[model samples]
Target chain A: MKRVLAVTAFTFRELIRSRLLFVWLISVIVLCGLDFLLSILSFGSTLQIFMDLGLAGMEISGLLVLLLGLAVTYTTEMDQKAIFLHLAKPLTRGEYLLGRILGFFLVNCLVVLGMGLVIVGLVVFLGGGTVPVLFYECVVFILLEMFVLTTLGLTYQMIATSMVGVVLYTFFTVFLGQCIGEVQWLLNQQLSHWVKVLLRVVYYILPNLEAFNLKDRLYDPNLVLGWAQWQDILLYAFSYSFVVFLIGWINLEKREFR
Target chain B: MERTAVVTDSPCAIQIRGLSKTYKTGFWFTPKVTHALKTVQLDVYENQAFGLMGLNGAGKTTLIKLVLGLLRPTAGSVAVLGGNISQRGVRQRIGYLPELPYFSKQHTGRELLGYFGSLHGLAGSALQHRVDEILDLVRMRSAAGLKVSGYSKGMLQRIGIGQALIGKPRLLICDEPMSGLDPVGYKEMRDIFIDLKKAGTTLFLNTHILDEVERVCDRVGILHEGVLKEVVPISKILESSVPVDYWIDVDGAEAAKLSGMPFQETVRNNGGVQVSGLVLAETLALLTARKAQVKGVRPLSSQVEAYFLKAIGAQAHLNRPIGGRRP
Candidate 1:
């Protein structure tokens, strides 16, 4: 436990100092800047503009966090041989993997939260009123979703060194996971019974990341989320993150330092 | 009451028996297993500076990795501090300094030590104390707060030693610890090893620096072709082992002519002829009988290298033929 905390602290400090963090923050600010400039044209309703701009910013920032997190982790330790110093001590592979995943997760969460706040501020200023309560709830879901994706991305980085592997795996887990249920239903309608069963199995195997995403629900009052649904999604996201970290831990355990 | 000095006989710091490691790589589905380490065994005592010498591709790094539990040996057992290295908690008592030390680019020397100290279960005031002590020991205290990215190669090496010493481990394993350092850096590392030994820390050092091995190590082991060929005390290697030629400054030409002694190899000189394999006592006896002025005798080791070469060549010749390969 002590080793975990020590490694986590060091990992967090490393994340903060990396150029990836600065680049991620600047990209979010740039998106917000472009959104503000677009809002001046009076193209749509204030809420419509705010929601569209905010969701886009959130998605882009999440992507930046994922790619940067993967790149920074894959190359830094390897190119520097810094991993040896840590492994040389009493630190276990499990503790080091956990520390890395949690550290990156926290950084991504903080970046997303900061962007969410900026979006809320822009909405209040444009609408000329206070931000809606649903915005806060949506922020929570967004935080949970980012946590899940970041953990999975970190696991991919540990298992595979290629950036392409991380990007491709993360894409399928996030975007394809959202469309899996629809794809399953479509496959059932078009294919034979056995193929439908296989497709359903495939759908169930994916992360179902769309379940935790509640951003669009903020504007649709009829699709309101109850506390039970929120709890379910939260539990699912946390468990998925835990499983990803477990895989990462096992992967690191089997790795030879050479 | 004063504690009784109970001497418990523990196994050597590292013991590997019949260890083997094979790495598979090929284009086909069926790969070829390259034998990186083959049936290698080594035992290093505590408080001894054991040097592992080998050329490239000799499995030196692989052996060290197995000892550190970084690599799983395909066969045999590795027991470190009386515990299986594959199991957890065995690493707490061992400190390793790798060949080329690297750090998290953002961490300063102090943070690196603190992290490693905490990893070894040191926390709070004790952890802080250890960090400070190690930093000062490696002479890195002044630059303790600078990020590691800005550190020079020598400074990085010093900080690497600091991290290894943070736990005050009973066993300190250093792999090529002086690889890229200048002469001064190398000397400083040697000094640190001496200090660690004084503190009763067992150091296992692996390097190709023959001179450094002679200066620091107590025992030296040579690794070749994934196997340990020889392990001898430093004293034996440093001393003249085989018969060496001696240069004796003696008296007159008449005295040299009078000497009908059997010198294995001889050369004529102005007064006294130079002879090979002449012991000091024999020379003194001859000089004393002749009542001639005798000077000092010097034993040369240049012939020792030739002897080693001949021995190695003879072994090679026995393996194959002079120019033909064994079918």
Candidate 2:
């Protein structure tokens, strides 16, 4: 556990020094600019628009940091062979992968939470409105979603041979993952047997990102925040992450540095 | 020539038998197979510096990786520290420095050392003390706080060696440790290796620099084209009567006497004759009997270099004439 944390801290320091937080700064400016413009143009409540845009900005910022971090680390650790020293140590390959996942997740957390605090501050101070309780729950859900994506991204890093390949694989997976609701809708419609089988395989394979997406239904009067829903989402997130982590660990163990 | 194992009393730090690595690349139907390492045998004893000498593509790096468990062998086994390298305890006792070591640019030298030390299970004040000691040993104390991105090549090599030693490993394996160092840095690194050897650290150095091998290594292995040609002690190579090239300086006034002489090659410009060690006496006698004034005689290559060339069957490729006949 100490060795894992050591790698985690080392990786975090590396990303921070690489100036990854600059993405958060740009995100805050854009989020505020978009919030103001959309609120002025829309006829709905201004606070609703503000909070909705803020949540979106947080997710987008987290994703940008993940993709960019993957590229940067792949160049140093893979292309430059910096991982030789780490693997040469007494640490196991699983520990290294876990540490890297935690490190990437930590950076993503900072970016997401930093943007969340900014939105909360604007709503309470400038708009003179109380923030909804669902906003906090949505933030937690976003963190869970980030954790799942972090595991998948690092798994792709292990399986990929090039930096571009890692980025593209994670990018397409995120896109398809977000379309789970539509795939479900397509399933309900009449379809060929073979096509339905393919859809079923993909649906079970890609992460059900729509499960953690509660921001869109923030104002729904029928929405219920219950213990059962939380349990299901949490279990799905962890189990999926564990499976992906195992795949990554196996790849790392079998990899040859030559 | 077949490889003759060195007879040593010390236990082997690394033991290899029938080890080979074959890489398969390209498409599946038409794969390209490269025999990087053949079925070779070697033993690196403890508490001694062993040098593996080879030309480019001679499988030196392949052999090192095989011993370290970085690459899975296609055939055979390697025992490091009397145990498998895959074991954590064995790895904890080993240290490795790659050729032209590269580290993440975002870390300071001190931070990097501390991190590696922690991986070796050192923590708290012990880790800090070890990091400090290594920094001082590598002569990078002043630059320890600076980021690695701002370091020079020599500074990087120092930190590389520092990390390798932070674990206090019993076996130190290095690939081209002297590469990219200035003369001063080279001497400092050599001094460090000598100190490590004195402190009871087994050194396995893979290098093309013959001088470094002669100065530091106790026994040397010559590898060529994926074959272990020979393993001999430095003292044996030094004492062997291997023929080396020599240059005899003569008086420029005797330039006329140099023509048509039975010497290898005569330099009329400097009134010098280059000859092999085999005919040095005969050539000097002829010069004396002819009343050609002899000024000085010097060897152009070291005995180790000549022996290495001869072991690889590359003597014919030497530029000097053989048996007093011009190539």
Candidate 3:
């Protein structure tokens, strides 16, 4: 446990010194500032405009922060061979992988909270209203969403060497996960019973990112999240993360550092 | 009688029998097999600095990696510190500094030491104490707070040694520690090796710097073409090839004549002469027998490179079986 904390702290220090945190900060500021301007110029339904712009900004910036965090965390250490120093000691592959994953989780959580605050502040300033509880609920779901995204990104980074390859693979999985609802609707229109079964299997296998989207109903106080629903989403996100983390950990254990 | 047989014990810090690592590179065309190490046997013991001397691509690093359990042995067993290399807990007492130690550039030297120290299971105040002690030992106390990117090559090597020595390991393995060091840094490293020896650490040093080995090592195993050519003691090698230098105060003509003697060279200076020969004792004896007044008998030392070349050359000539006695 001490070893885990030491490795994690050092990893966090490295991420900060790599200028990634600054990038996250600057991106959050710029994207939220632009969202504020869009809310101000909005003609019809100021609340609707603020909700649309704020949620869009939150989603885009949140995904960027997670992907950037994953890319910086994994690729930089690999290129520098800085992991060699830690692994050469008495550290097990599992400990090292857990340390890095936890470190990235902490960094991305901070990014989510920071971006959430900025979007909330912009919503209050432009729409002249207090932040709603549903916004807070969306924030929690986005944090959970980030956990799944970062783990999948880490899985891709483990197998792929090039940064572009990792980004493309992660983007593909995320896009597929996002479009599964639409694809399911389309498949329901003209499918035999067997085809429906196959599409249903695919839908269950892939992530249902649409469940995390709450922008349209965020202002409706009646749309509050209950305990059981939040628990199920959290469980699914954690299970997916665990499977990807296991794959990465096993590969890392068998890897020979030449 | 069936239960009375005796078993011989292995006498090495690491022992390997018929060790081979065949890496497959591709799925077709025989898989591009590379026999990195093959059928090698060696022994290293306590209080001895053992050198694995070889040129590049001679499997020196491969052998070290296998012994450290960084690379799995494909065909044989390796026992290090009396424990199987494949076992989990034996590495606690071993310290290794690889050919290239990759440190986080953003980590200060102190933080790096603390990080590695904790990995070795040292905690809190104890880890911090060890970090400070090792930094002082490696002469990096002032630079402890400096980032590694600002350190020079020599400073980096010193810090590498510091990290490897944090546990005060019983078996310390250094791979190419002296490469890319300046002369001052090389001498400083040699001094550190001697200090570590005095502290009772058995060193397994792999280097192409033969001179450093000759100066500091007690025993050396030369690996040539992936084969152990010799495991000669330093005392025997030094005694066999001790060089001699003498100054003959005789006239310059006699000095010139003395220079022409087989295998002798003369350096002239006004009325005196300085002569160097392959062996000083034989030359001194011959001069005394000839009634040539020897002003002084001084000894000269040969560098390890010259000594290594001569030794390898002589071994090549002595390869044949003995034909007859010198009757």
Candidate 4:
């Protein structure tokens, strides 16, 4: 556990010093700019628009940092062989993968929370309103999503032979993961048995990101905030992440650094 | 030197039997199998520097990676420090410096060392002290605060060695440890190896630097074409009757006296004549007798270089710009 923490700290320091926060800064500027523009153009309930846009900005910024972090670290660790030194240490491959996932998730948290703070500041100081409880819940959901994506991204890093491949795999997974709602809708529709089976497989395989898409349904009349839903979401996120993490660990163990 | 006397009796730091690696590449149906390491056997005992010498594609790095558990061997077992390398405790006793070692450019030398030290279970003040000692040992104290992205290749190599020694490992395995160093850095690295040897640390150096092997290694293993050809002591190679080339600098004013010399297989260049070690003495004697004013004589290659070429059956590669291969 100590060795895993060591690798975690090292990876965190590496990403921090790589100027990843600059992406957050850029996101903040873009978020503020878009908020200002949308405020002028929208018709009713500017607070709803503001919170929704702010939540989206936070999620986008978190994802941007994750993708960029994956690319940069992949070039250094896999392509340039920086991983050789780390693997040569007294750490297992599983520990290394876990540490890397935690480090990437930490950076994503910072970016997401940084954007959240900016949105909250805009709402409280400029708009003269109290922050909504759903806003905090949205941030937590975003964090859970980040955690799942972090594990999947690092798993792709383990399975990929090139930095471009890692990025592309993670990017497409994120895209398809967001379409879980549509896939669920298609499952209800009349379809061929073979196509349904393939879609069902993909549904169970890819992360149910739509479950964490709370920002889009914040104003839903029938949305429930019960502990049971929270329990299910958290359990699903962790269980899915655990499965992905295991695949990554197995691939890393079989990998030969030739 | 005393430890080297009993090196054969010492327990093996790394023991390999029937170790082989065949990489399968290309498509699955039409796969191309390249045997990276043939079924070979060798042992590196404790408290001695063992140099593995080979040409460009001679499986030296493959062997080192296999021993470190970075590569899975197709057909063998490696016992490092009398334990399986897969165990964390076994890895704790080993340090590996790959050829042209790279680190995350975001880290400074100190932070990198501190991180590696902490991985070895050093913490707090102990980790700091070890990092300081390693920085000083590798002579990177002043540059410790500089980010590795701004470091030169030699400085990177120094930090590479520093990180390898941070844990004070029982077995230090380095692939081309002296690469990318200036004359002074090279000397410092070589002296560090010598010092480590004296301190009873087992050194496994995969190097092409013949001078480093001659001055540091107790025994040298010559590998060729994924095969371990020979493993002989440096002392024996030095004592062996391998004929090395020599260059004798004769006076340029005695150009006319060099005309019909009775030396066998001697090539006269502009300022000197290159000859084998066998004819060096007789050529010098005849030159002196003719009053040709012999200036100086120097061996063209080290004994290890000659022995390596002879073992690989490539003695004709003698004049191919030594140091085994260009990295």
lDDT of model 2, residue A31: 76
Residues B179-214, model 4: lDDT tens digits: 899999999998999899999899999998888888
What lDDT would each prediction earn against the true structure? 0.73, 0.90, 0.71, 0.89
Pairwise DockQ winner, candidates 1 and 4: 4
Residues A65-110, model 4: lDDT tens digits: 8999999999999989999998999989999999999888888888
Which of the two candidates, 2 or 4, achieves a greater DockQ against the reference? 4
Model 3 misplaced regions, further than 4 Å: A45-48, A55-59, A69-76, A125-127, A182-208, A215-217, A220-222, B1-12, B26-30, B84-88, B240-327
lDDT of 1 by residue, A1-258 (tens): 777878778878888888877887788879988877777676666566666678768766876777776777667675555777677677778788788777877787778788887877767775665666777777777778787788888788777756677777887777777886687568748678888888877776677867766666667768767888878988898887888788888987887656
Worst 10-residue lDDT window for candidate 3 chain B reads: B1-10
Clashes of each: 0, 0, 0, 0
The Cα error of candidate 2 at residue B137, in Å, is 0.4
Poorest 10 consecutive residues by lDDT, candidate 1 chain B = B318-327
Tens digit per residue, CA lDDT, model 3, B65-158: 7887667777877888888754446677778887767676778999888888888889889998999999888889999999998988878888
Tell me each candidate's RMSD, in Å, in order.
7.4, 3.4, 7.5, 2.3
What is each candidate's fraction of native interface contacts (fnat)? 0.82, 0.75, 0.49, 0.88
The candidate scoring highest on DockQ is 4
Identify the superior model by lDDT, candidate 1 or candidate 3: 1
The A-chain TM-scores of all the candidates are 0.88, 0.97, 0.86, 0.97
Of 3 and 4, the candidate ahead on lDDT is: 4
True contacts kept of 2: 0.75
lDDT of model 1 at position A173: 75
Q: What TM-score goes with each of the models?
A: 0.83, 0.95, 0.81, 0.96
Q: Which of the two candidates, 2 or 4, achieves a greater TM-score against the reference?
A: 4
Candidate numbers sorted by DockQ from highest down: 4, 2, 1, 3
